[model samples]
Target: LEPLWLVGHTFAENTVGRLMERPPAVFATGASVGSVIEALREIVKQRMVTYVFVIEPAGRLVGVVAFRELVFADPNQTLDQIMLREPFSLRPQQPFVDAMREVVKRHYPVYPVCDDAGHLLGVVKGQTLFEQQAFEISAQAGSMVGVEKEERLATPWSRSFRFRHPWLLINLLTVFLAAAVVGFFESTINQLVVLATFLPVLAGQCGNLGAQSLAVTLRGMTLGELRGMSKLRLVGKEAWLGLLNGLVTGVVAGVGMYFASRGQTVADPVWLGAVTTAAMALCCALSGIAGATIPIVMRRMGADPATASGIFLSTITDISSMGVFLGLAALLLA
Candidate 1:
């Protein structure tokens, strides 16, 4: 058995090499099972053993033998006869995230780390890999709102401020854009005061729709589910979904607008309701398209998709929803 050494490193710094430990049980392929058992007896005293690695005389991994297999094997039989040949192994230099995606379904207790030539280096426990990945997943939520992945509850106020302020500034700039859109339609809003009342309703609904799309896209990206799929297909699918969802929700909102504007004199209530329906459906569909496209574009541009994604998403939804709603009112009622 060998000692387990813990190395402190961030998730980005982790690789199979840094996480692996010396295997407690290893034997040359030609070693007899009786000799392997004898060796295991001594190895078990110092560390836990699960799978016994079998390698060539030159230290290249050739097979793996489970403890259960060894317990029932003939003492005189060589390891090659019972060991599973060409067992799965992770490369020492592979990123921990990449390795995780490969082994997620296998759920092996331990994975052997190897070099390009299949020389055994060490082994990593499944628990360690999952723990690291869990931290990364948790950090992703904060990152979406412009929080740094490295920030913690105990992070210094100054550092936290620095990490957060820039994103807020960016968010403010986007908010101003949305504001500008509303201001551009100020005359229309004044003419139809009811439109002003429903501005928040349109923005809120579209924002929620966009957020739902963003969440699904980010989850897919994190799980490597987006690999090999056409980006155009994904975006198109989201847009279609958005359109369907918008049609349903828009009908409800349009009914609400009809009642709210019944006494208004500037425009016919029925026309206002129709305008709300059209704008709601169009803006919601656009929100979905923006939600799916933003992350994909950011990733292609070498930026973290989750970094301040919410801020950007809010900006798009606000501008589009306001612009479309007010424009429709001006066109139909003014």
Candidate 2:
């Protein structure tokens, strides 16, 4: 007899179970070759079959045999003699993404679905799983910048505005905070005046660098590389990368600032250059740490690292870049 599920509930929506169809041919462990061939003739007309599954007397899945094996076998042979005892199969409860991952390298036309005890449930096509995965991944493209998970591509423009504006407004608040940092160093800005001109240049560069780090961290998480890796080690690696990159970029930005300052009417070009250089290096290094740390912290706090990480990192980069640039000027050049 078929599993009870096949008669009543069938497959569940948005799961591998839902994607599965009743196998074209399923047999008990004791089934004879002649019986399987007769069943195959009826099934082959309805669907293609590359393999046939063999199950135990108690309805537990036991093995599989290529369709060719059945045609060539002696009519008296039992399915047990011809079947490959250990066959790959999916569980009825597996999500589409995990199922797709499992079947990535498999080139089978069909696969059996089973329960925890290996009872044969149904069969699913490999192509259906791949199609669902592609659709799911493409739908999530907007998730990186704080888009709501429920938002769809065909969502009304009004709904899209509602979904988007909240984050934009939050970003505006962080921009104000960055402005407040510069406001704190007004005395330094007043003394040189030229320092005000380079503020955006400094902040924008660090923000871009921080965004790069955030992208890489999110990618690692998505690929499941962070699963068994040490969080501290990941943090340490980002910090070192930040420092080394800052040193190189800081030297270049310093040279450019030094030359740029020569054309300005500043009282102390060398001191101004030194301050900008020091601020660049300091802000960039901290921004890297911020980029790496924010996502990890979000993950630990049970928030999605991808959705909110950009917002946290933006706040860090803007505040750190401006704060360091102006604070260094106040301490050195003011």
Candidate 3:
């Protein structure tokens, strides 16, 4: 009789009988098929089994080699001698798409999950793995290679950002905004030629310092190793780091300006130095805050924190850096 034809209470009984025996009701195949039959009998002694499906060599699933078949065949005959060999067999480790194709073709209920070496590890049945993870991972596109996409999604969200695409878009937008900010400063840049010379050196150092703090914050969030108190501590550290970075970058830019424009005319550079220093410091501090907060905020909002984190961070750094620089210049230079 068909396993599905049973009614409610009997269905539970049949399922309980099938799943909880000394060993679960697993069908077996391959060279040691006879030994598997004995294993099933041992399970029957515990009132656990209703049947076993044994397969033949070459991994073809022969007819259902149930308890009755075992009883009739052999006090002594090896499974190879009595087992059916001409049967349906799926390649172990078949591509999931291919397995789905076969399922439609063959009308099979279960497909084995296996290693490339053809050793079976588990089974996929009735769209279970797909139903669980396909929505989240189908964006991965095309066939999964090596590790299964199902296994990949099983990892925590923080560690799974690399698999997603939103980060790349955010990065493009942020960088464009930063570039626009630099373009806005073109008039000031042309008037104060020395400032143009030092722009990169100033921004480069600030960018590095900002990036370092951002990286620390992101890693902490991703690892699930940060607590509320520790986050406050991180912010404090980044603040101090911003100040340190501002001092170093300012000094470098100021010294370079002092030397590069010794005979050239510009405004009182003491004023320029002060404002540049403050802007660098402010930008670094804000970058650190933006870096640390964006991911945490994303997580709180029930989104993937890491997915667009890098882009958001770049945007924060760019906008803040340009705004601070120009604001300070307008105040001190104009």
Q: What are the C-alpha RMSDs, in order, of all predicted structures?
A: 3.5, 3.4, 14.3
For residues 34-149, write the lDDT of model 3, one tens digit per residue: 57666666777765454354443443344444456676775555555555544344443343444444455455444433333443333344454344334333532211111224
Please list the residue runs of candidate 1 whose C-alpha ends up more than 4 Å from where it truly belongs after superposition. Answer: 1-12, 152-159, 222-237, 262-264, 299-304
Better of 2 and 3 by lDDT: 2
Worst 10 residues of 1 by lDDT: 1-10
**Candidate achieving higher TM-score, 1 or 2:** 1
Cα lDDT over the full model 1 = 0.87
Query: Given candidate 1, what's the lDDT at residue 270?
Result: 87
Residue pairs clashing in model 1 are none
Which one wins on lDDT?
1
Candidate 2 lDDT score at position 104: 76
Which residue pairs clash in candidate 3?
A: none
The digit string of per-residue lDDT tens for model 2 on 1-334 reads 5654452345565678878777767778788998889888988998888787888778888999887888789999999999989799998878776788788779577888888888888888877877776776554436656687668778999999999889888878888998898898888788777778888878887888888877778778766688889888877777777777777777777777777778756446777777777788778778888877877888898876777577778788888888888777777663
Model 2 lDDT, residue 258, Cα: 79
